[model samples]
Target: MNEPAAPAAPETLEVPVAALRPSLEAVLMVADQPLDSVSLASVVGHPVETVVAALQLLAEEYDEQDRGFELRHVAGGWRYYTREAYAAVVEQLVLEGQQARLTQAALETLAVVAYQQPVSRARVSAVRGVNVDGVMRTLLTRGLVQEAGQDAETGANLYRTTRYFLERIGVSSLDELPELAPYLPEMDDLEDELERVGGLPRTPDAVQDHPAVEPMTDSQETP
Candidate 1:
């Protein structure tokens, strides 16, 4: 008997480095969402370091070639996306007629939310000098702000910027917010306003008390 055809040697599967890089790139490119380094490593059957190195190399290659896309770390993971330079073109094509633009009022309300986050709608309205009920709703629907929690005293809803806000602003954290000194009024004007208001009340020496201001709700209409 012909030695049973010598049990066909187990097929050896070899993945080339060049092919592996593109394979990884394709996976990241087509993914509908970001993929963590660990997940990518597992899928590629390689170490996390190897996956990261590959990602960096791919990013560099794209940059060197002036590709319209590159790898980005966003929302706690990595993904391939087009460069911002082509945002207008891509947005026009992808969004088509479905894109919604923010009104000036909405932008102002959003600014208030970004700087004084965890703030109530009342405070935001107070600062903007307009009813923010509709604007806040729009921002919420657009995923820019979210309800953080209710205030203990008034049970009013507190609002804060969402991760979408950070991503849109291209900031990794709130601390990266640009300084607003140039836009703000002078300290003397603020002090003068405080003086005009007969100065803020000072706490008693023994009983340190906090005011029971009503919690601000993003949903409430300015009455």
Candidate 2:
């Protein structure tokens, strides 16, 4: 048999020293999602350490210069975001009916998922007293919610918030979510509201034995 072909030579790059930052900037300007340092280093033909240092310097320079936008490392990657101090200015322009904001229903559904995930749509419906199938689809399409796995007993698909959700909400982790359980309605109130707002009338069995959402629990931690 013919000997295995010699491995192809590693690709060579000769990016000019002065062009490193500009070249990185150009690539990032068109990126729709965050790009990690390894990807950036590969593209710029630089060592990973060098690329990371350059990115950090660029981030600092932007902060020192008080730029309109600042580089951020979010969700395991780097991207540019409008500085928080100027959010009102950017929001004024971006929210002028040009971009669609999440509906109130969507927002409510999202909150339920963020707190109660990995939860099933049936449980969310029970909690909200309305069908959540449509709302779940919208969240999935928006990359805010994703299917986690099947519920062990019911076999229903469970859902959880994505890293993109954390990024959008400006939190580093799920544990950073605010403590709102104390303010939520009691379980009795929820059961009453569910019935009043068009949820299934619970039999005595469901009221006692159903594995529905508990009064927003403080002990539930992200997996």
Candidate 3:
């Protein structure tokens, strides 16, 4: 009887290839943060090519659907973020009262720090044509800027933007900052002033100092 045809060689189960793309999209949609390709592949137990292909498909699908959110590569990984068209709506909901509106002075100070990071407080003040001691303190308190290190020449504290700055600006990194060519004259002037001072000086105690330094607040008390 040919031993029942060798038991007909037990059948092996097959996984559906079409399900890969949807599975990857689901994972990305649910993740709270960006996911690296390698990490995603490891978690999904799939080849890198398969994962990449799936991600591209998902991104295209969102684009075609005109969804309010999309998958983007950011911070060296992929993340789902609200589309720019719906930024205002999302901002209204998630950032209500949480985001402080930036003052003109604060914006200027932030621009200086962003471009000339690892710069000294004295430098930032010189660039803004105003004392930034208070503004810098406000930024520090808000977690927008931090002491990157000490300036080797003058032992002054070197400051730089934090990850929060990137998040607030919706950029992956400082490299995304707009080209300054159109506004170079003004920026250059600020840089020159900072260089002249060798560094920004600590404000004298006589300056009207406010104890509660809040960043991006329109109603900050003048020190």
**Which parts of model 2 are misplaced by more than 4 Å?**
1-99, 194-223
* Candidate 3 accuracy as lDDT: 0.70
Candidate 1 colliding pairs = 120-216
**Model 2 alpha-carbon miss at residue 152, Å:** 0.9
Report the lDDT tens digits of candidate 2 across residue range 70-89.
99888878898889999999
Per-candidate TM equals 0.44, 0.46, 0.43
What overall lDDT goes with each candidate model?
Answer: 0.71, 0.77, 0.70
Query: Alpha carbon lDDT of residue 133, candidate 3?
Result: 71
Candidate No. with top TM-score: 2
Off by over 4 Å in 1: 1-98, 188-223
* Clash statistics: count for each candidate: 1, 0, 2
lDDT at position 24, candidate 1: 92
Question: 172, model 2: CA deviation in Å?
Answer: 0.8
Residues 1-223 of candidate 3: C-alpha lDDT, one tens digit per residue = 4454555776644433477766677788767468999988898888777777777777888899999998898997899988999989976865553467776777788888898787776666555555677777767756788988886656777899999999999999999999877876664454454344434223433121211111222343332
What 10-residue stretch in candidate 3 is worst by lDDT? 206-215
